[model samples]
Target: MTLGLTGLLALGLATSVLAQDYQRPSISGIGAVAQPEQIAAWDIDVRPDGLGLPVGKGTAEDGEALFADRCAMCHGDFGEGVGRWPVLTGGHGSLTEERPEKTVGSYWPYTSTLFDYIYRAMPYGDAKTLSPDEVYALSAYILAENQIVEYDQELNQDNFAQIEMPNRANFFADDRAVSEAYSERCMSGCKAEDINIVSAAPELDVTPEE
Candidate 1:
């Protein structure tokens, strides 16, 4: 009886293990991702060399109103940035430094990413609420603030990509020795030992008011 019980327990455990090992079907519905034909719904992007820019125009003067109403709350009136929000301009000479050097004029690579990021997410609370015309106007205003485009210059899908960023040339492909070092070794001699200590500095003492 004990032997029979042991065999039954082992069989049950093996069955449970087999059941747990079963893999579920990986098939997903077609609607899980946007179809290629749906590109027309939200494919607004202004690429460099002016490839995918749309048609519609906005002058810097026209953009100022849009900026004040939609952007100045977070980016400040002159694009200086508020709190932790991004600064839209400046950082002219910070590229060579090790600190967090950034600005729309200094850090953005592609101009298309700007139009896409803002069009998809902007105005803090209301996104996709800006019409294409409003987006073009706001983009024009921001570009002028960054000094990438002239104040009188007009921007639209036609000329949006022509506005070259100041720090566009700052970035280059990473072809350093570090890229090849990982492939040559795995466990030993992959890197150097830690050289710097990161202990916290002593806090300043403050006396309570009498």
Candidate 2:
């Protein structure tokens, strides 16, 4: 029997819905499986040993122009940082000071972090917009400004691992599981004695009254 136009359209819509449902075999049947290419696109994390660095190369000189055009507004002309932006250079030996300037030169434990961060998120609002070579250039420029690498030193996947960060020695593996002593779970009486209040919110005049 020939079906009406409306009945044919309804059957087509129902078939399409069933096809989509069949494609989604997840436990909740909410989404389809991510393809290999899609997973690869997001697996861009670089390790401290330069495990995931892409095939590309750049030098500080190559990055100088890029930094000026793309990064100078926020990071300053030489990684010194703008008004309230983070300083990226000249914080050496200041980690012990009252107000330590934890710039990339002084505190970062690996050069890979620089490459990874810039590749993942950077240039303020425009994130993941830089090419591999551009990221390498920027990383090299920052390293040069921090005195970690020479201005002409080339950075690439091969030599990326050799460029060690100054603070690498300061960072150790998390040994809390073995180093820290775990005692019995204490829900009550965690403190030695009863708590005493020296001041109240109303006395301090910090709380609003209804």
Candidate 3:
């Protein structure tokens, strides 16, 4: 197809505008290097084998008070969960149910995982602010709440490895192969059957129609 004089002028203008939009970033190497102290501050990972655990001690009795003060607003007393929050206790036998309640006690495989998670991310808003002793106490409280330990139990770096989770047997070492496929596995009661709608959306429609 051929372009008229006006069309040619228009195409040239568009090309010029596109050329003006492209700009290269400055190649200046002007950033400071992070110090070893700063890097160590952020490298706070705890391993499953009880490695990297900080030196501290806490009992379940001490944890209850700390949990109530720092965690009860979201996790609820006894770790039952509060108002759309995650339930931390119970659901001992609901893993195969339609709506599985995956709590720390019912699903997690290791106590170290619990300790690591809380140490890195707990109390919702405040992250990595609790002392090592506080983290131990909190872990004990949650464990006690789930009936994994007695209220008088103390958890520290020395005894953290001894506490075994109930669902540890459910987890197995990975054995996936390139040729293996899940389609060959028989999943009973997974067929498409008509079912009643027991629950529904809220009556108040806040979504836009358009």
Candidate 4:
């Protein structure tokens, strides 16, 4: 059977309707359709504006204890990073160095990132096992260790958006207006910029050599 574009579209629509009618899909042997609760469990999206933060509050002091107990084995007692593990603090003036050490305080541009990452992926082997309150505590502790937040301050969804990252001011809008070619080119006299010769084929070299 030869299927034209219209036939192919009809086939796709029929397949969609079949998928809707049947709870389980069997074409590729995907046996189950996710329930709303299942989808919610996996659909964790932390917005940059801190809108999707869960209802939970915690303090840096509370976070320090949690971090020491749950995270220190991999992250170190002070967020200095365990041996061969990720470092989460310091490196404030190292971006210009030959081998820059980018820590959470020195490079990350948002407070939400700290909350989101630790909530989703942390404690090395265990991921997404921390409760919302525990995640908030861990987030606050890391922020305090990196000197972004006071060790006594409580962090929650209400105040999370107010927390500013140290690298926030460094990022500016990318404006390539001057770099773009918007008008007709002056092929000769205006061509003063550096030009790299990308390839050379001796047989295809048609220009006269001076």
How many clashes show up per model? 2, 0, 0, 0
Worst 10 residues of 2 by lDDT: 17-26
What do the candidate models score in CA lDDT, each in turn? 0.77, 0.91, 0.87, 0.85
TM-score, ranked from best to worst? 2, 3, 1, 4
* Candidate 2 lDDT by residue in tens digits, 49-120: 788999999999999999999999999999999999989999999988999989899999888888889999
- Candidate 1 residue spans exceeding 4 A from truth: 1-37, 98-100, 176-198, 201-210
lDDT of 4: 0.85
Can you give the lDDT of residue 91 in candidate 4? 89
The residue pairs that clash in candidate 2, if any, are none
- The residue ranges of model 3 lying beyond 4 angstroms of the native Cα positions read 1-36, 173-210
Residue 146 Cα positional deviation in candidate 3, in Å, after optimal superposition: 0.9
Comparing candidate 1 with candidate 4, which one achieves the higher lDDT?
4
Candidate 3 has a TM-score of 0.68
Q: What would the TM-scores of all predictions be?
A: 0.66, 0.69, 0.68, 0.65
Best by TM-score: 2
* lDDT over C-alpha atoms for residue 112 of model 3: 88
Clashing pairs in 4: none
Root mean square deviation (Cα) for candidate 1? 8.9
- Least accurate 10 contiguous residues by lDDT in model 1: 200-209
lDDT of 1: 0.77
